[model samples]
Target: MRPLAPSFAALACLALFSAPALAHFQEVIPSADVLPEGGEVNIDMVFTHPFEGGPVMEMKKPVKMGVFKAGTTTDLLPRIKQSEIDGKTTWSLETELVEPGASIFYVEPQPYWEPAEGKYIIHYAKVVVDNYASGEGWDELVGLPVEIQPLTRPTGLWAGNVFSGVVLKEGNPVPFAEIEVEFINDASITAPNDAFITQVIKADANGTFTYAMPRAGWWGFAALVEGDEPMSSPEGKDVPVELGALMWVKTTDMSGK
Candidate 1:
């Protein structure tokens, strides 16, 4: 005799447990974190699961992109060019850095609809590039709606260094905000389990959090907060929106000559 079919609830539970929980990271990575002599800086922006390093999501043209340096913000939206990775849409920009200070590159992408979560995602991502290793302007704020203000210098760090930041929403500290950390896996390392993919932490009462980098690579810190109002989904339904303020920092190992 044939076995009885499983109930709908049982199948749903199985599917939920079987799927891996991979956190989404909006990556705005520069070719070099510290340009000693001030040269061209190539920036790549992608929306994907950074730890797994694949299954890239299509990123629409960003609404705004620019650089903040020396108390000024320069628009770089027109310089951004469309690209594709694994058949998914991405973006890149190249700009020459002539100054001797830190340049904070930022991008505000269009809202992406995620049907599975029943919410839209809008990640305001940014990174810092220190020209001539001047070290100044590394702590300047880009004034994003939801932003991670770095307490530690965002560039020229050794691999084992601790990176700290404060979560702010609309220029105000967001106490106990949740932050997700992930490394840009180069396919050289493998996670032992799904739980090891994304590292989760929460800010303190003052909205500050810290994490240490174990290996030499780029790491992203995303401070997540829910939007004030719901947005219209593709299906014409009202859904919640997830606002992620992401920042990327690069670390290198101390090598002997």
Candidate 2:
């Protein structure tokens, strides 16, 4: 009986060590969330575990990339350039903002096949950049198949501000959707354990979720929903698709001069 007890303890340890990996966020981050006078905004797109800040997955050229402003969407796919980080493929875009309005930059990346999860991942990620400090047009939707419509202004936020948004699938609210939140750790912070890597929250009956930013950096909120159709894996097996509507927000710390 003593030997059996030791074996049981070993199995328990293994289970703890093999806990599920942290959440993956498709990051579409801008160099500056607010442009005081309208200038060139450099945007970086990456797919990786944001909290751990490592093991960056290879990102293929996005199928669609554009900017929505003033009730119109302009195709910016031609501006996208292939880049690399830690030898993994990423993307970058530099666009000039000359108008006084909020610009919504969005990317629809190619589906990534994840063998560990036995599924494909497609994250339609977007971020809001205010040009000339114009407050209008921050709440306009980019019309992504899945998206987060920000109830609060996505830009010019201070640390500790509660950011809120609603999960939308096909332009309709998805009741009680599951959302994963993560910070883009820049090596200045370390997680105490795996549990702290990714924070999970659920939307309310109206499909709205909110979280307070504790630090000054980029934060990602991903509303995950299962796709309606299954896609074939590279191995020719039918696998489900995980559709994520991700939005990026930046927070700044208030300092006394």
Stretches > 4 Å off in candidate 2: 1-17
**Per-residue lDDT of 177-216 in model 2, one digit per residue for the tens?**
9999999999999888878889999999999999999999
4 Cα displacement, candidate 2 (Å):
5.3
Q: After superposition, how far is residue 253 of candidate 2 from its true place, in Å?
A: 0.2
TM-score of every model versus the real structure: 0.95, 0.94
Q: Give the Å shift of residue 96 in candidate 1.
A: 0.2
Stretches of candidate 1 above 4 Å error?
A: 1-9
Worst 10 residues of 1 by lDDT: 248-257
In candidate 2, position 6 carries an lDDT of: 59
Quote the positional error of residue 4 for candidate 1 in Å.
6.4
Model 2 clash pairs are none
Q: Write the per-residue lDDT of candidate 1 for residues 1-257, one digit (tens) a residue.
A: 99999999999999997897668888999999999989998999999999998789999999999999988999999999999999999999999999799999999999998877889999999999999999999999999999999999989899999999999999999999999999999999999988889999999999999999999999999999999999999889999999998999999999810
TM-score of 2: 0.94
